[model samples]
Structures are given as structure tokens and as C-alpha cells.
Target: MILRCNTGGTRTDNFAFFIYAFSSLFAIVSPVGGVITFVSLTSDMSLDEKNYLASKSVILACIIALFFAVTGQIILNFFGVSIDSLRVAGGILLFVVAFDMILAKVSRESVTEKEIDISMERSDIWIFPIALPLLTGPGTITTIIVLMGSAVSVLQRGEVIAAILLTFLITGVLFHFSRRIYKFLGYTGMLVFTRLMGLLLAAMAVNFITIGIWNIYLSFQ
Candidate 1:
């Protein structure tokens, strides 16, 4: 809990970063929303099938997220894209998504009804709509990359990794019991929670935009 971080050679607190990583990822990933999608997609499956798909999809999503987070800086360098620039762009993208969520609308950046309908006919759905676009889509990937860019030291990097793992772990469990969750939370309850997470995500997006702008100015000076 007392973990410290060395950011650009200056000693600082890791606790704040840990919270930021965890909360922001949780908000963007929004396991509750994923669970609702899972319930609808797997309505015909038995408990065992539902559980298996849940585990598989969560594992695959975590792997994809980890890949981007671990190699985020390398990707940035290869594309000659600065983190500051990415933060601004990613931030704006996230805000658009958050705005959708705030209105209880599904963002196409995450997934769409047509994609979900098409996915229902696929055999490897756990890999398709569930793992790929549903759970860890463009918005989630961009958020991870932006967070990865902020993590400077080994400890900070580990924190980011931990956050990704924990987020998916919870998501897996939620999907495992999606039916019960749907019964408990119902559609209305889930929408309330989604809106709250969207508000949190919107705040984080603003922070990302502000930081990116400030840093860009500093680079010019």
C-alpha cells in the first residue's frame, strides 16, 4: 500500500496511479455491460457452456489487453506517435464512448447490434464478439496504451499489469454468473450502474485531455 514510484527520476506515490489504473479500466471495460451481452448471447446454453465461454472469453480479452499494454510504447515508437498525441486522441475517443454510455446507449466503438447478431451465428463466439469487440475493443485498448505510456518505472508497469489482470478476473466471474446478476440487477439497475461508470470515465477522459495538452505545450517550450 506504501508503494512508491520513480516518475522521470522524481520519487512519487504509486497508490494514486494504482487507483487510477484500476478504476479507469473498470469503468471502460464495464463488466456489467459485458455480462448483459453475455446473457443475451448465451440464452440457449446450459450452465456449463455459459461458464466455459465466460472463462475462455475473459482469458482471451486479458491476453489482448496485456499484449497492447506491455508493448504499447513499442507500438507508439513504430508508428512515430507520441504519447501526448495519443492521449489527446484517445481521450477524445473515450469521451465519445463515455457520452454514449452516459445516455445508456451502446457505443459502436465497443460493439453494435448487427455485430452481436452476426456473432450469434459464429461457433467461436468466445473469440469473436465476446472477447474481441465486446470486452476489449478499441476504446479499452487505447485506454490501456495511454495508461501504459504513463507508467514510467518497473513498479509502475507492474501496477498497470495487475490492474489489467484484476479487471478481467472480475469480468470472468461476472460472466460466470451472468444470469443471476441479470435477475438481481435487472436491465434498469445495470443501466444506472453503466451511467455512473460512464460519468467516472468521462472525468478520466478530461484528465487525459488536459494532461496531453499541457505536456504538448511543455514540449514546445
Candidate 2:
């Protein structure tokens, strides 16, 4: 059996795959990176209201994510879509988002402050910006669909679910303490982290594009 070792200790391939799944989801979802925006938008809310919003947003995001992960392939097939084409398109979308993130520009996929302002008057703000684009935008959905499509085994699929749950659990906790996290990190620290995550995402995007292209080429041969 092939084995790998790190400072932590020796690990098997399964463990490595879990780590890959978790990290990929974490990088794309980026709950911590969105804390500042979350805090800013919720500044006028009471503590209880903030808590309610956080909980609801997480619940909605989790549901949406699970739905896409489970039904992603069926949706693709129904639409006559191929996983390779989705991957290439999704990778390009991710690259655009990452480029904006690296430059500290609010990604078009994400809600702008003005949009948030307009959305604030609505009761479904939690469903819209908080849960929709903020937590599971096009890029996030694309990643979910692509990853689920790539899974070949029940165990691997379980690992993906585990990763999704873990990522969102952390997301809820982070939003619960959004104020403190924002206070601790401040704007500059948050910017640094956002940029770092952007770099990671950009790398992932390139990997996705490369694999998609390679597979598509192989299919023709």
C-alpha cells in the first residue's frame, strides 16, 4: 500500500482524500473571509436577531448545498450537460471571482454594499445575500456539482458530505462570533486572508480547467 508521512504522522490515502475534499470546500466557501461583510450588514441588528439570522442563513446554505451535491448529476444529465464542460466553465468563473478577490474588489457573484443596502429592507435578506450568493453563489454551486460528479465511490461521496457539513458548521460558528472575528482581524488582516484564499482558489481553478481539458481530449482519442 502506498503511504505518506507528515510531521503529524503516517497517513493513508483515504485520510488524504478527506483532507483534499475538506480543504477544497473550505477554500471556496470561505466563511471567515466573509465575516466582515456579514458584520457590517448586521450591525443594526439586536444580538438575538443576529443569532437568528446566522442560524437561518446556515440552515438555508446547508440545505442548498446538500441538494446540489445530491442531485447535481441528475440535473446535469437532464440538461444534457457534461461534467467536463461544467468543470471548465466553473473553473473560469472561479478564476474571475478569485481575481477580483485578490484585488480586494467585491466579486460580482457576491452582493455589493449597495445591493446589501437594498436587500436589507426585505425580510428574506437572510435567504438572498446571506445564504444565496454570500454562502453558495454560482462558483460554490459549480464546485459542489463538479466535486460530486467526480466521486466514484460511496465512501468518497460520504467524505464529501462530511466536508460540506464541517465547512458549514465552522461557518455558523464564525458568523455567530462575526463581530469578535471582525474586531480581532480588522480590515487589513481580513484583506490578507482574503487574498491568500483567493490565491488558493485560483490554483484550484487552474487544476480544474486542466483536468477537464485533459479528460475531454482523451474522450476524443
- Candidate 2, lDDT over the whole model: 0.86
**Residue pairs in clash, model 1:** none
TM-score of 2: 0.93
Leading candidate by lDDT: 1
The models' CA-based lDDT, in order, is: 0.89, 0.86
Per-model TM values vs. the true structure: 0.94, 0.93
Candidate 1 local lDDT, 115-201, one digit each (tens): 888888877989988999888998899999998889877777788999999999999989998999999999999999999998999
Give the lDDT of residue 55 in candidate 1.
Answer: 94
RMSD in Å for all candidates? 2.1, 3.8
| Residue lDDT tens for model 2, 11-42 | 56557667877888888888988787788779
